[model samples]
Structures are given as C-alpha cells and as structure tokens.
Target: MSRRTDNRHRVATICRRATGLTHDTCLRWAADGLITRQRPVPDAGTPQQRAFEARLFAELAAGAVLGLTGIRPARAEPALALHADRAREVLDALLPRLDGTGALRGVPGLRLVPDGGSWWLTDLVDRVARVRLLHPRPGWGPRPGPTARQDGGRDPLWRTHRHALHPAEAALLYGRAKEDGASWDRDLLFSRTLRRLRLIVDAGAQHGWVRLDTTGAYDLVIECCCASGALKLMHGLRQSALAQERDDEGPGYSGDIDVGGACVAVRHASCGSFPQPVAGPDLRWVTC
Candidate 1:
C-alpha cells in the first residue's frame, strides 16, 4: 500500500521494518531517547501511534551506529586491517631466518627463544592485533583476585597489577620518530599496545607463573611476559651482568641495582569488587 495514502499504515510499516519493534514498543523507545520522531504528529486520531513509529525507526538507526544491531558489518576488514598488514610484514622478515627445523637458530635483530619448553615469540604480534580489534580503549579494568581474598589484609599476591609498555611497543604505537607527528595510526597503535600489555599481564597471572617483586636487588621484575620467555631470561642476564660488574669493581660497588626501567605496577585491592577476572597461575608465592 502507498504510505502517503494511509498514515497509520506508513508509521506501522516503518517502525516494524526499521527495528522489528512493535508499535507500543516503538512508543516507549521514543520516550526513552532510544529513538526520535520524524515529524510532529497530527492533532487527530492515531497521532500517538504515528509518533511511536517514527521513534522506532530512529532507535533502530541508533542501534546500528552503536554496533548493537544484528545486521552490523563483519569486523575483520575495517578493525584489524592495518594490524594484519604490519604483522604480515614482521613475520615475513623474521620467518626466513629460521633454520631448516623451523627454529630461529641464527637471525639478526630477531632470535628464537624458549618459554615453558616451547618456541614462539609468544605470538606477540597476534596478541597486539587481537587486543586492538577488541578493545580500543585507554585503560583496562582492575584485575580479579581470589574469592578468599575478598576481605582486607589479603596476601600481596592476590592483588591486581597495572603496567605500561616498554620502548619497543611504545615506539610502534607513538611512531618510531616523534617528528612524524600524531595521527589516527599512532593513536590506534598506542591504544592497542596498552590493551595488549594488560592482557599479557592477566594471562601470566592466571597461570600462576608470573611474578612481580622488588625485594631483590632490582627495583622491578617482570617474569614470563615475553614471547620466548625473554623477559625472565633477560632478568637472569641482568643478574649475570651485575655479578660480573661487582667482581671487576670489588666491594666498593655495594649499591642498589639500577633496574628502574619501566615496569608494570602490582598493587593490592579488595577482591570483592575487582573489575575483571583473574585467570592462569597462582601467584601467592611471590611477595609484592
């Protein structure tokens, strides 16, 4: 039927067509700001119904904009396109250097490292890409804690930890050189990197393998956050370097280890209201 000929029919049709909303539901949505009326209703019969239908269509449009609509487009292309391209470039450059056994036996700038008896860059590129696609936000919620730790004075291991990235991730996000200036690309990279680091921390905590303690000579310690477990290995390397320095310089070098490079901060919070779930390992052994 021609919409102009029957106003009620037109209104009902648009309401149902746009949002699959009933006439009454459309009216509620309109009142709730979920939708808006297209035009002023006539001062006659069915005015309320006409207003309701207009609002329904508006709500439906809003739904589409907020990605709440069922008919939204697939996210593969628009969300992760750039990330996928960069990952491909990094892999292409690094993969060729692997030995005949698919091991990074001899590669410059990139080396094959081991973690949990496995070999992988912890698939960091993929981790960064996935995090960017899912959460393009500035910060993450608090990490979860054990149910027993809900009350005060829980062990430090049950606390939530927050961390910022190191130079490599920051460089990718803010651009290799500062003079290149800010752009959407840099913003996306920075946001993605933050999200990825949070995820990495969470995953490590869940496995009960990650530890953050400053009691040792080092000011900050990060264990098991790298792709090849390089973070842990790096800690050993630093200790070795310090030992060598001490041996060469004698007892005069009785100073604090200057490991004050950037590290994720771990702090205790009440477990009852933690913002997110904590998965993986039990970290109770590592005192904060």
Candidate 2:
C-alpha cells in the first residue's frame, strides 16, 4: 500500500486503490462534497478517524467502480439484512420523486452498503430480494458507456438533474479539470450553481439525496421553484410543513405551497430547457 503524509493523499490512497482513481480525482471529490468522510475536515481529524474515513471511502469507491462497469454493487448478505427495513422505509419515502425515471419502481428494497460514488440511489430491491441500481458517474451527463448518454438524454427528468450540475461539478464528477472561461462573466453561471450545490451539501450530514441522513437535508433542493416563486410564497410556505402525499403509486412526501389556499405540488421538473412548476402525476426527482 502506498503511504502519504498529506491528508488528501492519505484518503486518496484508499479511494485510488479501491477505484483506480488518480489522487487528484479523490481530492476533487473531497472538495466537491462528493465523497463525504466521517471526520471530513483535513489534518484536524485524528489518525483513527482518518483511518475510518479511508475504509469508508474504500467501500464506497469500490462499489462505484462496480457501477461504472455497469454492475450493481451489493453488500454482503448479512450486513444488508440488518438494515433491510430502514432501506425500504427510505425507498418508500423517495419513490414518487423517481416515478418517471423507471430506475427505482422495480426496486423492491435496498441494502446498507455503499450505494456507490455519490451515495445517490444505488441500494434497491426487486421482487426476489435487494438489488442495486448502478450509480451514475459524478457528471450531470451520462455514465461512460454505450448506452449511458442515450439513456440519460432521452429522459427529461435525467436532463433536469444534469441541469443542476455546474461546470465545476461536472469536471469533478467526470474526472476532468475545473473549467475556466476566458472572461469572468462567462464563468459566472457555473460558479453560482457550484456555490449553491456546495452550500447545500456542506450544511449537511446528508448532502441532498447524494447521501441519506436523518435531518431531511434533501427536502429543500428537491422542492420546485414554483412552490417558493416569490417572497409571498416563502411567507405562505411558513404556514405549513412538508407532509407525506401518499397514493396508489407509492408513499412519498412533498412541501406544497399554498396558493390562494390551494396547495400547489412542488414537482421540480427533471427535464426540459425550462422546468415549469405545475401539478403533474409525479416524476422521480433525483439530484443532478
């Protein structure tokens, strides 16, 4: 095993060995909030804490490697069995957002293992037992494979997730360099989006659906702009709390904004050049 004094390299060693990633890619993932650590701060954490981070990263990265190759990474059966119930609960809560994507409807349940790179939504179960959905690469674009781009492009919801990615995020997720445009204004758009994603993820132990946490960190980002279109909307949003809107499709929750006493569903469109805020049946709202 390679050893390093630098904290980035120390963690990178685990990530690299696990997924054959370059040290720089691992560093970028850390900077981008892609792979969260137990004690995520730099040299400030203890060696034992650091070691734990490495192990966790290794597992996550290893699973990601499997996913990149179009394989659904699974946890050891015993380990998966313990958290089976929790997995199903979380999945139940998340399915409506995934309605149109067709990625999770077939999912019967999930496992506690590394759901891969972003911890997006790889854990899943089918009729027989728990299976995993292949985690996408870090990009808002498609995974690197024959069908990745075609599959991703065809789905409007998938495109909306892509819209959420900033150029910087795109770079890190795709193993590329940070993009730099010739002029400041040209780069502004990407910078602003990246800032938003960074801010949202940093405030979390749960960085949106990228990782699941108890605090419901994803609740905000997934909500559509229509629900909070204006200052008036925010004031209205204060009137009520996010509640589960369950139906025959599945059990799921959303924060609906009261518009003239009419609750408007916050269905953030996952596709199209302009994502509109109107009531629709349901679309799986996975993160970009």
Candidate 3:
C-alpha cells in the first residue's frame, strides 16, 4: 500500500501509543473543539484530514505532559482545556516559521508559561512573550483546594506552571520535515509529539526511565542516521545526560530548571543504556 494509505490506517494505532489515549477520546476532543474547531478525521480520510488529526493529537499529548510538568497520563481533560487555545496558537505560529529544513528560522528557544488564566509562549532566555491565549476556563486550577484569594481574602492566587520545549519537540510537533522522494511519516510525527513522555522500560540487562518510546526512538534514529547509525545518537544522548548527572545532584535534583524531564530521565537511566534526549538533534534551530 502507498505510505499515505498506510499512514491513514495507522493513525489510530500511532495516536494510541503516543498519547496513551483511545481513538474515541481523541476524536471526541477534536469533535468538541478542544484544540481545534475542525472536524475529526474520518475512517477513510484524506492526507489533510490525517494531518489535522495527528496535529491535534500531538498538541493534546503535549498539553498533558506540560500540564502535569512532565508526568504523562492516559487522559488529561483539565490540562487539555488549559492548553487548547495556546497549543493551537503555538502550532499556528511555529509551523510556518519553520524553514525548508524543518528548523525554526530566527526563533529563540521557546517557553510556555501559565499565568492568571492565560498561556504565553515566550523567548526562553529573554522572557519576552511571543504568543498568548486565554484559557478556556478562566482561573482554572486543581479542584477542592483553597486558592490564595480563598485564604483570608488575600490576593487571587495563581501558580505559574512554566515548561520549556526542547528544540526537537518543537520541531516534531510543528515543523515540516520531509523525506526525499517519499511522503514524510505522519505516524512518526504522532510518536515524536509524544517525546515529553517518560517511559519506564527495561534496557539491555537493566531497567530505568527512558525519554522516548523504544519504537519511536528507533524510528527516529533510522530516519535521521540510517540503519548503520541506529541507536548511536540515542546512546550518545543517554551517555551525555549520564555524564551531566555526575556533575550535579542527579535525578534527585529538583529545582525550577527543567529540560523537559531529560535531566531526570537520564539520571535515572545511569544504570541502563536507554533514554533518548528531550532535544532530538543538536542542530542549531535557535540562538538560545
């Protein structure tokens, strides 16, 4: 079958693996206009239809990860609601900003900040806000808790949850990376969108936390480095993170600084040989 047809068939499988969400949930979210107002993909759909579904699923998955600050869950409705418009805005702004090589042109490393009832995408180093969107439910927070205002009539409380996207995650979710003479793998895009996930799996002879799903990691390596370099970069990423762990407090180090959980996963994987980096390729996508 043509790759496109194959991809259409695999969308459900790939989305399930990537988002840990059933096909029904994603479609329902899409139908409810959570992320986008567009109609969900049909069983037999066009490439555009598949792309739309893939993008929405990816965005939803990212929201789930960032909402919980690196903890990926099977379903996160509240997180999805918090991120819906912002995710759409980010995808809208960044996708076209990518050049022919799937790298953001003249963009800085981006950070997402939740303040008050809005989500802002900002320049990481400068703290300059680039894109902002109001949350679907204003003043939304966890349930059954006292907000600052609720406590003795103090100022309205808002906890800012900020997350930085590794360049790879940004590109995978929003960039248009094409393969030579072949349609890019839309299924790969779904899987790559799930990079924020921390998978606890057994490596060769050991068990530890891995950043990328094992199948997704292999597909990424094969796509970028070919069969010969398969797993070379993945190993390098694990090794590099392990080396960094020794110089710091290791996985136990829990400060505000976050590399999208790359630090924690690598430290945890020190005893094993897995865990890809949060940032995919070290290519210079941004100045920061």
Candidate 4:
C-alpha cells in the first residue's frame, strides 16, 4: 500500500543547521542513508507542517540536539534555490554566455585561456551525474534494523553540500589536468571568494566592491546567483593574454582579472551557485 507524502521537517534535520557538521560527515551519511526523514521536505511543501517543524525545533532547542549525529539534517537547497531567484537581477549582463537552459555556455569575443577550459563545463555535467542518495520509505520512518537502504539517504540535494566535485575528485575527473596543476583544489579559494562576494551582496545599495582605480568610459558590474555567473565571468578572462593568476596548484580556472590597469576580482559561491553583481554609485563594474 502507498501513503501520502507529508514532507515534514524532523529533529535531526533541524539540529544539523545549528551544529555545522563537516562536509565529509554529511557526504558519508548521505551515502549511508542516515539523516532522511519519513517524508521528503518539499521545496514549498506545506506552511503548517513547516511552522510545526519550527515549533518542535524550539521545544528541543534546550536539549542536546547537535550531538545526535545519527539523525540526518534538513537540506538547504530549497532555501538556496529560493535565494537563486533573487539572483536573476543580473541576467541581462550575462546574456552573452547563456544557453537555452539559462546555464553558462561559451560565446565569441571572450577568449577563455588556461586550456582545457571547456572541460569545466564537461566537469560540471560530470559532477552532477555522480553523487546520488537513497530515499526514505515515505511514511514508514526509519526501517527496522535497516532491512533495505530506504531512509532518505537517496535525496539528490539531501544536504546543502551535495556537490561531487572537489580538487582531489576533480583531478581524477580531469586526469591529466591534475598532473599539470591546472585543475587543483579550489574549495578553499572558492570559500574566500564566497565570503567577499557575500560582503558585497549584503552591503546592498552600497555597491561597496566597486572602488577600482580605473575610470573606464563605461562601468559594468558582474555577479552570479548561480554557478553560471562564475563560469561566465571567468570565461571573459580565459583568452586574455594579460590575465594574471597562479596556475601552479591553483584552481587556475578562475580568479581576479586586471583590465586596463584596473584590478577586478572575480569570485563565486562555495557550494552550488554564483550570484551576479550589484551596481552602486562611484562603482563602475561589479561581478560576484
């Protein structure tokens, strides 16, 4: 017999938010099917159920919720996807590289260097293909003694950090690129970029990031709300001969670009998507 999917949040799911579990632990659990709730958390599932989840969370807030590693946490993708909607403001600036899917694609006039550059797109597709999870047996909650793998471990975006690509794994994905140092670990650099970009984003109306030295004829701002933003921004500098960056064991595919003696830093989100830039007075060009 089948049952209706309630899509309610659980205690373990709420706890993961405050605890800040490591990415590896999340991945392992996702692989093992530990944190899944009886029903999947809908993107906009139900207001009443969600509010109740919040109330239950408050009730358990005083207890030891963080240490319950056995329970799976709630996924952040639904909220992040919601955030991605606000990122559409910069869609026009990046139109040059967008394809039918609204994803990033190569275009003319911008020569992306660092060879194997196109591979990033290939890698993007590759990573998305890998990394999957098992789902829970809706309405049944946890299985008795774990007869079969069905406890919410299979949800694609099970947790916010569901990405399958990393420097080490990405290296293997690129094979030869790993040997040359072009495809190095980028998570750390990506983290720093995320922080700086968020600073720019949070400082809304200030357009605080655009205090560059160049006084070009035109001012443009580029920022990302999805992964494509970073891809499009980096693609601009790919073919430029003057692009200055560290390719030796560096992510090498992205970084700041210096144009006409002006330094414009290009940054992206750490986990999933990159956002577009915000324009403010005195700031000419901005890209997130």
Task: For model 3, give the 10-residue run with minimal summed lDDT.
Answer: 200-209
RMSD of 3: 17.5
Best by TM-score: 3
- Distance from true position, residue 28, model 4, in Å? 20
Identify the runs in model 2 with alpha carbons over 4 angstroms from their true place: 1-5, 30-106, 109-288
TM-score for candidate 3: 0.25
Per-residue lDDT of candidate 4, residues 1-288 (tens digit): 113112112322322332233445533443355433421111112332222223222222221111112222233211111122222222122112323453332211111112121101011322221111111222221122333122232211112112333233333336543455221112222211221222223222222221211124211223433345445434433321212342221333245543333334444433222223434233223333
Best by lDDT: 3
Which prediction has more favorable TM-score, 1 or 4?
A: 4
Off by over 4 Å in 4: 1-86, 89-124, 127-179, 185-187, 195-197, 203-288
Ranking by TM-score: 3, 4, 2, 1
> Per-residue CA lDDT of candidate 2, range 96-203, in tens?
123435443211222223343423432221212222332232423224444432333432222334324333323333542244433222122111111122222222
- The candidate, 1 or 3, that scores higher on TM-score is 3
Q: Clashes in model 1: which pairs?
A: 121-227, 122-227, 206-279, 206-280, 206-281, 207-280, 207-281, 208-281, 208-282
- Extract clashing residue pairs from model 3: none
The alpha-carbon deviation from the true structure for residue 84 of candidate 3, after best TM-score superposition, in angstroms, is: 12
The weakest ten consecutive residues by lDDT in model 2 span 73-82
